[model samples]
Target: MHTNTSTLAASAVDRLRQEIFDGQLPPGTRLAEAAEAKRLGVSRVPVREAFAALERDGLLEFTETGRTVVKQLTPQDFEELFAMRLLLEPAAARSAFPLSRKQQQLLSDNISATRKANSLNEVTRLDLDFHQLIVEASGNTRLLKLWRSLRTELELWLGYLHQQHRDRELDTRVDTAGSHEGILDCFQNRSAAACEKLTREHILSWREWLPMAELET
Candidate 1:
């Protein structure tokens, strides 16, 4: 019974997370444990668990009146998060050089998958995973933890950006793959400095892709 409950909670988390990410449950949307449990055909126990997990992920927040609602991201949120990314990711990527064979393979596989991904959601997920693998390869426990803490928010932002691009009929496959290929080449060549420089440049360039004007809408 305990195992079943745990499974249900994990499933609820995935469902709720995808809904939130897909904009089905947009920011500021009220969420009730009872209603969500009914909708997911699970008991309130699992829904409560899911709620706690999402709150930890920075996707759910309680209002002054104690009503739980989806967190509304602001332009400032993006700026602040990207600022931290600029600090954390490049440093991590710098140290990630001379990666283990396993790490290299995983990153290579991720980029290939991203290139072939049919859905924007898949591409966003793989894109984030590519960065995550670099940070993990750095072998710094604290740095990995810090990066994981920001991952969900970064994912939400990237997903939004991808959707905006799609709406504008932009195909990002080439640019995204091209950037990763360059970084991977640096890794292949064992140039840590080049990797760091390219990684920083890659991240900094996202400011151009940021959907600043769409934040209010």
Candidate 2:
């Protein structure tokens, strides 16, 4: 019974987190426990528990008025998230080279899904997952765990980026997809150096478009 209750609380938390990340519950929106509990058909206890968990994950800020609001990712948050990815992803790509058949297939599938994604949020999720799959395929449990810990903040940053940008030209999407394909091809061909170089270039490309000062401020 206790375990089931805990699982329910976790489910509630994940659902709430997704809503916030997908912009259904925007930053600065208040989360009233009673309202959420009623909406989710869960008791207040679980709602409160979920709120506390989200707070710890840096997704929510609790106030003196006993209200919780979704937190916004500051510029430092974006910088740190990208910085960590820069450190981890290139290494993962290099490790992924000499790829096993399974890893190659996974990368191919991720690229296909990214192309097929109907919405911007879907594409963003696929992009994040593609990097994660590479890291996990490297067979480094510690790296995978650390990356998961960073995902909440990363998702928040991606959500902010998606919301702030409106232009979605086909050429831009094709360019992004081509970058992933380039790294995948390098991995498939067992070219570790090439894979690492492409991965670094892909990450650094963010600087070409993303506004550094606006995001930081």
Candidate 3:
């Protein structure tokens, strides 16, 4: 019974998460446990558990009035999120230098799969997976924990960026694959400094597409 309840809760989580990513449940949309439970054909138990899980994933938040709503990310939120990415990812990549042959192959496979991705959502997942594999390879458990904690927020931000690119008819697949290839080359050559620089630059290159107005320093 416990295992079955857990599975139902996990399923509820995935369904709701995808809905949020697909914009079916846009930001600021309120969610109710009983309603979602009915919609998903599960008991209120799983729905309640899923809500708490989504809250931890940063997709849902409780208002001061105690209503559960989808998270509303602002321009400042994007800016702050990217700032954290810049601080951590490049350093993680540097620490992951001299990646093993198996790790290298995994990255190469990820890029190949990304190139063939049919949807922006798939591209976003592959993109994050590429970076995450590097972080995992770093062998720093604490760093990996921190990175995982940011995973869902990063997905939300990157998904929004990809959608914007799609609306503008900008195909970022080629650019993304090329950038990964360049980073892989650095790893192949065992150039930790170059890898760090390239990784940092790769992240900064995405700043142009930010929805935020540039603030004066």
Candidate 4:
């Protein structure tokens, strides 16, 4: 029963998270407990718990009126988060090499999953997993925890991007894969400097690609 309740909580949280990410529950939209509880087919307890969890992650805001609403990503927030990713992911890439065959396979699997992803949401999830796998493979628990902390906000940003651009191009996929491939090569060659450079470049490239106006609004 304990395990089932835990699973329900997770499910409720994920459902709410995805709704926010997909713009179905847009930023600043109030989360009404009774309404959401009915919509999600769960008791108010799990919904309230999920709201608290999301608020802690900066994905939701609690109003003085006791309403919870999705939070918008400010431009500063994006800059800070990406800066941190630039700092950490490259180091992770440098440490990623000498990977067991299993690690290499995992990377390959994520890449494959990205290719097979049919929707923008699916692709976003796979991409997140791909980078997260790299971070996790770094054998640094602290870095992994930091990355997890950023996941909710990152998902919101990525979701906005996907919504703004309905169809993802093949070129975009290839470009992203190339960046990951470069990092993988650096790992394979045991060249930390090169990996770091690639990671920094990848993070910085988002500046050119992201919709600045949308983020600010």
Candidate 5:
């Protein structure tokens, strides 16, 4: 019974997360537990558990009024998130330096699939796969764990951002995969400096387009 309850809670979490990410539940929108429980066809227990999980994931927060609202990211949140990525990802790329030939091809293929990903979710999955591969290559257990934590937060935030980025015509050509092939080529050729440089530039470039104005809305 305990296991079943946990499974149900996880399912409720995923459904709520998708609703939030797809903008059905926008930032600052209050979530009532009874309403969500009814909507998700689960008991209040699981709904409450899922709310706790989402709060930890940074997608939801409890208010002073004892209500839960979708989290509203502040400018500081955005700045810290990107700044951390800038420091960690480039360092990971530099240390993931000597990836074996097999790892190289795998990362290369991940980038290729990113180019053809049709939906924002698919794009996000491929993007994470590509970068996580680099982090795994670093073979640093600590960095791998940190990267996973970052990925959870990134997944929550980037899913919405990437969808918006793809919707705009001018940004349409600026695929996340654009700098990937170059990065892989540099890594494979053992040009560690160039790989690190390309990775850093790509990370910086993506942040330049994040929808900062959304924080107000």
Candidate 6:
């Protein structure tokens, strides 16, 4: 019974997190456990547990009225989170030299997968996987740990940017794989400076001009 409850809680967390990230449950939206429990056909226990987990991810917070709500993001929040990524990722790429054969294969797979990805979410996921491979290859335990800790927050921002990109009817035909080819080329050449510069540019290419209302909610 205990194991079943835990599984339910984990499922609840995934569903709620995806809803929030996909913009179905906007910021400032109320999170009522009873309502969620009824809607999801689960007990209140799992819903409550899910809330606690999302709260820790900076996605939910309590209002002064003591009600749980999706926490709003700001433009500064996006800038800060992305700026941190710029700083750490390049440094990791610089240090993650002499990639093992397996790591190289992983990166090669990500590159191939990116070209075939159909949706923004799929592209963003593969993009993260590519960057993570580079970071883990660095062999710096502390850097890898910090990067792992940022995964959830990173997913939210990446998903939001990709969604906005599609909403504007931007050129979806642009080759996402083309951007990373240079980085891969640099990696193959063992040029650390080239790899770091290419990686930074690749990340900045995805930067979006977020609307204030969207950021605030």
Please tell me which predicted candidate would have the highest TM-score against the true structure: 3
lDDT-superior candidate, 1 or 5: 1
Predicted candidate 3 versus true structure: per-residue lDDT over 1-217, tens digit per residue: 9999999999999999998887688778999988999999999998899999999999999889988999887778778877877988899888999899999999999999988988888888888899999999888888888888888988887776665457632367777888999899899985888888998998898787674323311
Question: CA lDDT of 171 in candidate 4?
Answer: 54
1-217, model 1: which lDDT tens digit per residue? 9999999999999999998888788778999989999999999999999999999999998789978899887777788888988999899988998888888889889889878888887778888899999999999999999999999988887776666557632357767777887888889986888888889998898777556525544
Candidate 1 vs candidate 4: the lDDT winner is 1
Scanning candidate 3 in windows of ten residues, the lowest lDDT window is: 208-217
Model 4: C-alpha RMSD to truth?
2.3
Model 2 C-alpha lDDT per residue in residues 89-202, reported as the tens digit of each score: 788777766788887898899888878777667777777888888888877788888888887777776766675563753544566577789878878765788888888888
Query: What ranking emerges by lDDT with the best candidate at the front?
Result: 3, 1, 5, 2, 6, 4
Task: Report how far off residue 198 is in candidate 4 (Å).
Answer: 1.0
The superposed Cα distance between candidate 1 and the true structure at residue 4, in angstroms, equals 3.5
- Per residue, candidate 6 scores C-alpha lDDT tens digits across 95-174 of 87767778788888887888778777777778778888899899889988888777777777767666656763224323
Candidate 6, superposed: residue stretches over 4 Å from native: 167-175, 208-217
RMSD of 2: 2.4
Better of 3 and 4 by TM-score: 3
Model 2 lDDT-worst window of ten: 208-217
Model 4 accuracy (lDDT, Cα) = 0.76
Model 4 scores a TM of 0.87
Off by over 4 Å in 1: 168-170, 211-217
RMSD of each: 1.9, 2.4, 2.8, 2.3, 2.1, 2.5
TM-score versus the correct structure, for each prediction = 0.91, 0.88, 0.92, 0.87, 0.90, 0.87
Per-residue lDDT for 120 in model 6?
74
Candidate 5 positional error at 63, Å: 1.3
Question: What's the CA error at residue 81 for candidate 1, in Å?
Answer: 1.3
Evaluation by TM-score, superior candidate among 2 and 4: 2
